[model samples]
Target: RALAQRQARDERADAARLYGRIATAHTYAGRYGEAQRGWRAAAAGHRKNGDVAAAARALSELARVQEYAGRPEESLRTCQEAVEWAKRADDIRLQAALQLRLADTLEHLDDPEAARLHRAAAERILEEEPGDRDPEPEHGANACEIRSAPAEG
Candidate 1:
């Protein structure tokens, strides 16, 4: 893995892609922190390489890992950043992906309004997207309905 990373660094575009692969592997290995760090590096590299869409894609994956690690708030922040990056890149596909991520995170955080907003955004974007698309598959389905946030204890 170290050798792969070194070789990846020799080429900027390849380095960004390798960092994403390494980060995914780290996530599979149950190293959330390491994966998050690697994803951050990948995001930075993508942004520097003028691939804002790719950067947003990395951030979306990082947010997914964060959500799996039980950090909903952090995941939301990361997803929001990814959404902004995607919008800046004018990549509708990436924007829809990020919206779904944010929606899933918000759903877990008990922010039904925000989650619904993102869900609608995702649906709208997916409607215009070419080819077959399923938003639910891309974004995890919610365990609870989006009625409203329950009262705090």
Candidate 2:
């Protein structure tokens, strides 16, 4: 929290990272509202820093928070925005992950067919990559719903 305050004051890229951590902590602590706010801040910071990928990631996290808060429609919209950003950033992996998240949101919104389509799209992306397989079959045919831990820098 203190790191977030310091980073916010400095208005640096590190601020976005701190906000992401803070949001994750909030989510783990069951503070959905705070988590949403933190994710929004992180997204804004990433955008300001010209880091489209990070902004999309923050938006993805925001969508998850919205889903947790029972706002499937909002979550779906956020996921769409994240997808767009990922495409703009040319990050195929992130785009595929966001597509899966969108699929989950669509399922929550009672659009099973659309959800299935998204799962298929994500699967296709993974299949096109060499040596990539469904790491967790328990998560279903795509394992698209699995939340991967953030990569360490």
Candidate 3:
């Protein structure tokens, strides 16, 4: 939560990590609106720091929280933005994961054909990686750890 205070003071990098922590906690607690807001803040912080990949990840989280909040159309747009950010980062594995996420959002949006195409694209990208597939981000600490930390009063 110290990070949040720092964020409030206009410290972007610390704000980004703290927001991620807060969002993860909110998600666990089923507070989707708060989670979405936290993640959106994190995305802004990441973008300010010139970390497009991190911004993409935050947007992906935001999309999921939006879905949980029963806002499928909003989630779909956020997922699409995440895909664009992943593409800009040139991380094929990340791009593929984002494409799969986009497919899920498209399915929720009632666009089966678009969802299928996105799924196929992700599959093709994975196939190009040989044995490498399903790469996840390497955050040092787990979500529970982040949640356990005391929030600043």
Candidate 4:
């Protein structure tokens, strides 16, 4: 945290990345409040630094934290905002991944029809852009795998 603050005083972009890492650590530690705050700061800092992709990713993580905190409605809103940011970033893979996440959130909210629509949208995105693969894994797995997993019977 101190290092992130120090970096914030010098390099806003780097500090935003540090803040993201801190937030991820907090998430793994089960500290949802700290994670939420850190992710919000990271997203804002990244946006202020003109790193829309990073900001979108931060928002995505924030949405996940909200979901983990059992606030699916808030998660849905945050996920929607993240999808918009991903669109502005022109990152097809991130957009698709976020759509899948939205689908999952929707399912949790008892909106199966909306979830199916989002899942189909994500599939279309992946099909339309065969060459676009995310360089980094999202949520500890391949986005495609997340999208394509078969339902448990």
Candidate 3 pairs with clashing backbones: none
lDDT of 2 by residue, 116-143 (tens): 9999998787677666555653454533
Off by over 4 Å in 2: 8-11, 128-153
In terms of lDDT, the poorest run of 10 residues in model 1 is 142-151
Q: Put down candidate 4 lDDT per residue, 32-118, tens digits, no spaces.
A: 999999999999989999999889889989988888887889989998998999899987778888899899889888899999999
Q: How much lDDT does each candidate structure score?
A: 0.77, 0.81, 0.78, 0.83
Off by over 4 Å in 3: 8-11, 129-153
Candidate 3 vs. truth: CA RMSD?
7.5
- Which model, 1 or 2, shows the larger TM-score? 2
> Over the stretch 50-97, how does candidate 1's per-residue lDDT look in tens digits?
998889889888887787677878888887898898889877666766
The candidate that wins on lDDT is: 4
lDDT pick, better of 1 and 2: 2
> TM-score for model 4?
0.83
**Model 2 residue 107 distance off true place after TM-score fit, in angstroms:** 1.1
Candidate 1 lDDT score at position 84 = 93
Q: How many backbone clashes does candidate 2 have?
A: 0
